[model samples]
Target: MHTFAPKSIASHWRLIAGLLPWLLTGCASAGYQMPDLSLDSLLGSDQAAARGQPVADIGVTRCDQLTTHEDDWDRVNGVPPVDGEDIDIAAAIPACEKALAEHPGHRRLQAELARAYAEAFRYDEAFRLSGQAAEAGSLYALIQQGHAYRYGRGTPKDIDKAVNAYQSAAKAGHIGAMNYLGSTLYQRDGWGDRSKAESWYRKSANTGNATGMANFAQLLLIDGKQEEAFPWFERAARQGNAFALQQIGTYYAVGGEPAIKAPYTALSYFEKAVEKGRPSASVKAAKLFIQEAGDTSSRLSESERQAKVLYWIEYGMPKLSTRQ
Candidate 1:
């Protein structure tokens, strides 16, 4: 083996200079975190199932084990659910089909297969199956129908229809549906109703919905009610909501009525948000490392600080496009 020469200081500086533009671009765009309209948010967890409400048997089939969304209301004991993006659509579609074939006329299986189809972008199949399940009184299926109409997956985009479906499910006391209704009303281009959105969010939050708590808290933060928002953010964070974790990090980074300035603690929360799939936190974490490096009173040596910065840049660069 041949001995290798270490990189020169100039080379290191040159590398950092090359990376600076990418880092700054990510940081600049990080200010506007888009509202989450992800699959998990759309197909939220089933509070009724968690409360021991009677639901169709979902654990008996291999399809259920493979395609069950992590937030799905019904889960089989000992079998973990996967995130929406984590679903293997090709495999899930076939598995669900086989299960439905075995248990003919099973509305729940239809809904599950519909979800798999939706994930695969086979919106026509998703719409058909979800419609069938909705007719059979599956609130989750109704929500899926709303999503299809709202986004025009396989049907014409109809906000009124979407709102109607969400309202029907919300009337049935679906916490996720309430949150969806709030999001829809709050973000509906020119006709958004802030008062109605706030009302729905408050309803969901009162029912202990983590997403609702986070959404309501965001509105409070926007209105400069940091002290009031902090508790709600903390509540959501305790339930492992990534957005709430990031918000808490922001509060900690800047001294405020409820949150004291704590850079190290803030950095930890940012890292946690990254772990929870909030890529925007990566830039925040990197910036904090750079700030710590520049502070002469900090305990880290110059070389150590440089290494940390490099590590963060490399770690966060690939994730910048997945900002949430």
Candidate 2:
């Protein structure tokens, strides 16, 4: 799984943590009314596919006495070890703890449990478990440890330690680590080198990491190489990256290249991204709606345009504000 910044609500845990407060406050000063739907329903049913179903939903009734030998244990775990964004942190603790007790040395399980701990905001336990998993040779654990150190989650914020952890994991062939390391180097400001960052991103992309592809394309775009960047962005979007999806939609809407520009196609992509929990897509959708309405050649009416803008403002503002 790709690790997003703390400010971003892309991860299930971050979304839940951030949204819970705003959901209660109502932000009345902003003149925004809370929706009638439960906070859980705010994300909608598509979250199952977006986040992955949880262990309980996968028919594993007992988190205790878990089968560590199962092949599924080696795969990446969604929150609470299944495909949903709404994680019950309190409930997940015991099951994950019991599994670790039984399997004592299972690296993947340790890493997954570390992620569970991290999501629950139990950073000390998350860091400890990540270390244990890393010692057991789990590359995923190494990445988790890097994140913990990077943001000072459980320990001091040490960029050097974070870089070391990511380098170790990337060298061991962890794609997520590779991409993250690239990003860290890219965003390190004065100490960061774009050329170095771009190389690492390319290396990650070569390994078929979708996030890496998106990152590389973004760098290309920064260099004004839109024609070269287009295919890479499309590739990442096909891999279900919401950022890439929105970027491709923006490209299509703006007509950078005559061959690919199409407002309807752009609208479809923006809608797809919005369903995937991307707040920017809502604003983009609003802009495109108004733009299409204003086109003298289009059949859309003024009323429809206002309705679309109003809908997105009502819908997107809450999410965008929470992220900010």
Candidate 3:
């Protein structure tokens, strides 16, 4: 819902090698197309700026100044649902539409309105404005275009174009774009540029991208640096990545050397992850709860075990299916 300035694109990728792990959370390069679903919970420009590198410095409209169009822009950014609630995505649409009607040449406003459109499931409008913003050098808009192209939401599904879009944005120092570019290049069946992918992930991770941190950590684990990877996973979890939260649960449940196996601790983490909207957490919690209950040395009673198992099977599996 906010706009940032774009960055200058870099021509070549840089690599810093040590060790890497398997990405538990899905990456863009895994041959997975964009889901034909709501992009409601977006990685907004404001959130991205808070997380990592600052984008190009686009000016914010002053609230005190009152050109009707500027006032509309301020309202779109400051008003109820878009400002805090985040649930009612449609609330800002009219304000953005009115502002654009009066100021169609404003590129930042165009990108912001495009994102509002995307959140409202108006892909055709989203794509049009995003393309305009990209042409005007908006890094975030380039990322949006990548999403549109990948999903065939408002355009044909073109993996090459999506990759190009992500790459372009990544070069411009967009953190999400860097993470996505890494994902696409890292996939074995896809472009399969391990070195380039790691470089991209490292750049994002270095800039404090939570997904990048988790992904880079996963690769590190794969390379046998469990000790090194644990801290990155911890960092990502602290940043509220659902995948990292669930992975931490898995870590505790299936403990490695230097980490004591604690099923109860694992269950606690799994429960927290579920509360954070990860379905995998439910499966892990249920599995571990049942395991602990079934273990003869444990103190859980027969009634408690039955109750827990029933709760998970009856409540968790259905939810997991829906997530898939």
Candidate 4:
């Protein structure tokens, strides 16, 4: 781990979006709570800065042409599969099947076909494809296979099988699996301990996985271990993780004054995150700036950009799960 100054959050300037896609959802209006799992401050303070959107997952942009996305592509993965019975999905299965038949040995094609099957509600076919691909040990195959088992797409509900699949992916150095596995172990009575989570998180982080660092730090920050979490947040922020950037900025904004409602430092953090396009953070930061005398418009725009956040929210809305 390395260290950097917590200097002015006003340092950042470029307005262009980062390389990765953003996922956002507006937190329920004030008193409304998220269903099932506990969520405090759904649309975090940073998200509320401009549009104040809260996100359940990252929005995947069409950088790579995989019609099969991580979201509702597998309805069984708790993403509430897309309401197929449409022309697009109807056409998708045949295309994938054709690709598979020509080359049954093509694991990636097989995986894609499995996604097509799941989307079409052909559970049995999807399971067969996913299982075959996973056993072949393709990274994509393992993740999809794990999702099939974990989400019980075309397969039976088998948490143990899902865990095993995830472990296989992790062993193969799958970033998502590493993050998910760490998180899985973090919420246990005696099995998934925090230390284990941190260890797994570090492994993923060392490989430059931003999600691992951000989620790991988020857990630590919420647990009131700010000092320890600081480095992790910094690592992720440097990777252009807006959420982690906001967390670091918030740490400094709190004044380090020991119990004065440290909004000062938090204001700077909110500004940095807002600049990095955290809608909620930007809006909340604007409110804080006017109340205090900080330079709210340094790196951030005076005019709020609500569309990015709105788009993020709309894109991610379909994937929200009622199940914990």
Candidate 5:
């Protein structure tokens, strides 16, 4: 593991679909969409030993749920949990609350519910649920408490307290705690304490946290330490980290010493990344394909490059945007 900034790599959660995108929505109703795709096989499907049945169909309507008052679509804006994105605050909140009640005692479920409340700007409820969750003492639950305190979801702003909780969790073997703590320190922008930010990132990476490794690599690469960063990126990529794949693609595209900057190699990495189902990488790879192969008018070029962008936008973005 290496040291890097929190934002240096893509956010931890962004790797969900690629790392292991399984549904946690708990929507066991008649209309839920269940794509039967496994990310590992997704990229190699055409050449796969056998074509697996789709676990869920993205096109499923879930019609009644969409319009039902109980489904909570009213509050969601259809955006994802990615930072800098918007979500339907009001409807989503009630939906999550309803879910929590139905699946009580599931810490991940409660944490998500609390997070939804926090996302919707409902601090009181977020705090309440997070409190209950923290009492459960789950890693995700403790992280929720940290979220409540630092972001003032229910309590006043207190960086120190949030840091303490994160540190405690990090020490207690919560890998995500390392991410949270590292991110907080990195955001501090204490020029004199840049090392401190990197230190926390190392703690996170040492925890075998994929996000931490990705971020650490990102930090090193951005700082012109690609020599050191490549290993970290490889570490995360080995775990099916789409972001790391994209980074490797970039290295290949650029032709570094250890990594030959061959468009073919880059394409291989990008295509693999796209197959593993990283939307951004799909788009990036598509963009690169076009840039390298020229415009869509060429018959051969069009077939190869054009398909990349289509899937990236059509199938990729929607799935990513709708994900929690």
Candidate 6:
């Protein structure tokens, strides 16, 4: 992506230096090695950026166009698929079924159909199709199998089997699978290894996966390494990750070494995150408007400020209630 100017790069290094003590101390206490914080390491390669570039269409088949998951490593033409929850399940199920019928035994079509069926709550069909697709060497299908086992969809819930499915795909170089495996292990309570989870998250982040970057950054934040996590969150935010956008907004809201407190900038990011499906950010944005209105230095009239605050509260109220 976006190129950093020389001045901005220098500023970032200064911020990193200010936070180094916390990072080193945190890592030492946790018995984990410190991560490389150099700009080169964080920026990665041009290829990694290219990998995340989105294209308008894949033009493979109607089913492929409709049901390809956004996180699939094998996505052709850099086609950006809809998120699972955003997929038009009714349309996708029929479209994928028709496509599979037209091209019998196509593994990718099988996996795509499985995804649509899963969204439609046809768990048995989803599980069966995903199994067939996985046997036919579809890495994406393995993730579906993992989800089915993990959530007890059409079969008994089996965390071990879920891990196996995700691990297999991860070992085979599926970026999304690495993130999924890390998440599965991290949430497993007594059996979970935070170290293993971190490593898996790092692996996925190194591959330029947006979800991985966000997850890894979150883990770092939890470990009291906010300085180290900031850049990763920025990277994921640039890739349009909703969670990362919200996190960046939060960082801006609180003045720190890495982020200067800028209410306007924070509000901009919060609004962007809300547009990207992070409803909680709406509350943050609304609060900022109210804070700004009360600021003696702010130029906006009281009425204008009140209107902005009202707009955000009303817009966000419905979503906040539904968020867990």
- Evaluated against the true structure, the overall lDDT of model 4 is 0.54
| lDDT tens digits by residue: candidate 5, 201-290 | 775676566778988888787788988888888778767677787788888777756576567667667766776667677766666766
Which scores better on TM-score, 2 or 4?
2
Candidate 6, position 195, lDDT:
75
> Per-residue lDDT for 247 in model 3?
76
- Number of backbone collisions per candidate: 0, 6, 8, 25, 14, 0
Each model's lDDT? 0.68, 0.62, 0.60, 0.54, 0.55, 0.70
Against the true structure, whose lDDT is highest?
Answer: 6
Better-scoring candidate (lDDT), 4 or 6: 6
- lDDT per residue, candidate 6, 1-324, as tens digits? 122211111111100000011111132214334334221232235422322233223358878777887545445554557667678777888898997898777777888998888877889999999887766656677788889989999778987678667766665566777889889878854433577678889987876678889999999999888889988988888777878888888887776757777777777788778877787888888887777654422777778777777777776776332111
How do the residues 1-324 of candidate 2 rate in per-residue lDDT, one tens digit apiece? 111111222332111110111112221223323223231232234421222122222323234223221112235334233432344456666777876687675666676677667776788988988777666555556677779988999888877667667766565455666688788767754333566578778877765566888899999989888878877877777767778888888887787462255777777778777877787798888888777754421565667667767877676785332110
How far off is residue 124 in model 2, in Å?
A: 1.2
> For model 2, what is the alpha-carbon lDDT of residue 320?
31
lDDT of 4 by residue, 1-324 (tens): 222454543333111111222222332323433232111122224422322121123233121123344421121222222223332665667776765676664555666677666766777888887666554434455566666766678778665555455554564455677677576556532333566567667766766677778887887777788777777787777666778877765655554622234555566566566667676666556455555543433444544434433443443344454232
When sorted by lDDT, best at the front, the candidate numbers are 6, 1, 2, 3, 5, 4
TM-score of each: 0.77, 0.70, 0.66, 0.58, 0.60, 0.75
Task: Please identify model 5 stretches exceeding 4 Å from their true place.
Answer: 1-113, 119-121, 190-192, 275-277, 294-304, 310-324
Off by over 4 Å in 2: 1-73, 76-85, 258-261, 294-305, 320-324
lDDT of 3 by residue, 1-324 (tens): 111111221221222222232222343433445332112123344433432232233344321112112112122333222221242344567766666676665656677777667767788998998777666555667777888877787799876677677766664455667787788767623445676677778877887667898899888878888877777876777776667777777777787554567677667667666766677678778878867654421676778777766765565665332110
lDDT of 5 at 28: 23
lDDT per residue for candidate 1 within 1-324, as digits (tens), equals: 111111111110000000011010111112333343322244444432322234566457878877765334444556666667778777888999999998776667888898998888889999999877666656678788889989998899987678667766665567777789888867764334666677778877876667889999998888788888888887777676778888888877775568776777777787777777777787787787677544321778778767766766676676332211
User: Residue 265 in model 6: shift from native, Å?
Assistant: 2.3
Better of 3 and 4 by TM-score: 3
